[model samples]
Target: KKRYKAQPIVLAIPRGGVVVGYQVAKELGCPLDIIVPRKIGAPHDPEYAIGAVAQDGSMVLDQKVVKSLGISSSYLEEAKKREIEEIERRMKMYRKNLSEPQIVGKTAIIVDDGIATGSTIKAAILSVKKKNPALLVVAVPVGAPDSIAAIKTLIYDIVVLATSYSFAAGGQFSQNLVQTSDQEVIGLLQKASGPQ
Candidate 1:
């Protein structure tokens, strides 16, 4: 609050990031929201992200990786279409009746559980950038050193608790690697948006 004159709003990347964002919003005494950015995984290895597509259809792709992997333009087009559909489904399930928070002229803090390749978070940042926030920040518990370094070039203010040299994935740091369900995301959003 003291750092920026503008109002701070927390925007979490669902479904794992919602839990972390809720806590951050609660601590900052600000409103919490979600940003949907679906990862465009590699053809053979689904876990390997070649790019990501945001809710507004904005995409961030690793062109070098795409070319190196020989991923066709048609493949990317199909992947984006499929991801956008999933984004729509998620927005419907998670947002429900809630309207998107007013981000223009406010401090938009994009929160995620952690960063691995930084594809998803990069897409989220691009989507939020269109809203014209006064300031953009990325907050996460942990992230890979290389990923965090790459992300640093995108945003000025980033709060990362830990950067691990041995970082394999975000879930590796957690005691429980269980996937956060749609129900859990809905519940957390409801709780955060409730009496404060």
Candidate 2:
């Protein structure tokens, strides 16, 4: 609260982010929401995110990686289409009422457990910027040094608990980093919107 001197709407990058953003919203007595961004993976390397698409369908791609890997345009187009479909599905599943928070003219804080490739967060930031928030802030528990540095060029306000030069994985920071399920995400959103 002192940082901004005003309550900000917390937008979590869902699955894991919802967990962290929920607490932040509760602390400030502000609204909690989500921004779904799907990573566009490399062919045959689904875990490797070469790009990402936000819930609003805005995307950011690493042109260098795309050219180096010889990723075809057809592949990228198809992948984006598929990811967009999944994004819509997730939005319906996570936000049952289909109503999202009002962030225009309000400070918007994007929260996540950690940042890895930074593709997803980049996409989310771009998407949210279109809504014209008074300010945009990213809050994460930890992130890779290089990833965080590159992201710094995009958004000025960043709050990270830790930065590691040799960050292996987000799971490394947690004791039991289990795969976050859709049900868990739904529950958190519900609790946040519940009666005070």
Candidate 3:
């Protein structure tokens, strides 16, 4: 509150992030939006993310993991293409007629339920950086200590409520890890927008 005099916009990484972001935006009386970044999972294990692609086609990849896994360029390209398509679909579904949030002179808080590998959130941060917000802050309820430290190198301003050494996944820290639906995201955005 002391850092920012004007209202800061909260950009959540859906679908779980939206739920967390909604509460944050509501409490702060700020606008809530979504930054859709699809994870590029490993070929063998789809749940294991090797990289992520943001809405603007920008990506963040674990080069070591990509190379060590012998992920071919063709496979990466295919995966990126599919993820981009999904990103487009999600943007259309979530934003609908809403214009992109103007964050040039405002603080942009990128909220997420938690950070595991930090690939997807990194992509989201990169995508938001293009818009040139006055300040970019990464806020999450919980995160891996190493992952949080990695993100700290990119942006110094970040807030993580808890850090776990045994962090297996984000869901482990949360009481409710249910999958958030697209409809729920839309409703939250609408509610945050407040009758617009």
TM-score of each: 0.95, 0.94, 0.94
How much is the lDDT of residue 75 in candidate 3?
93
Residues 1-196 of candidate 1: C-alpha lDDT, one tens digit per residue: 6786799999999988998999999989999999999999999997798999998988999999999999999999999999999999999899888887899999999999999888999999889999999999999999998999998888768999999977766756985778889899999998888898
Residues 22-97 of candidate 3 have per-residue lDDT tens digits of: 9988888788988999999999999888999997888999999999999998999899999999998988999888
**Alpha carbon lDDT of each predicted model:** 0.91, 0.89, 0.88
Q: Which clashing pairs does model 2 show? A: none
Error of 3 at 62 (Å): 0.9
RMSD of each: 1.2, 1.4, 1.6
* Model 3 regions more than 4 Å off: 175-177
List pairs with backbone clashes in candidate 1. Answer: none
Regions of model 1 farther than 4 Å from truth = none
Which 10-residue window in model 1 sums to the lowest lDDT? 167-176
Candidate 2 lDDT by residue in tens digits, 67-159: 999999999989999999999999999999848877888889999989978899999999999988888899999999898988888775999
lDDT value, candidate 1, whole model: 0.91
Pick the winner on TM-score between candidates 2 and 3.
Answer: 2
The per-residue C-alpha lDDT of model 3 at residue 161 equals 95
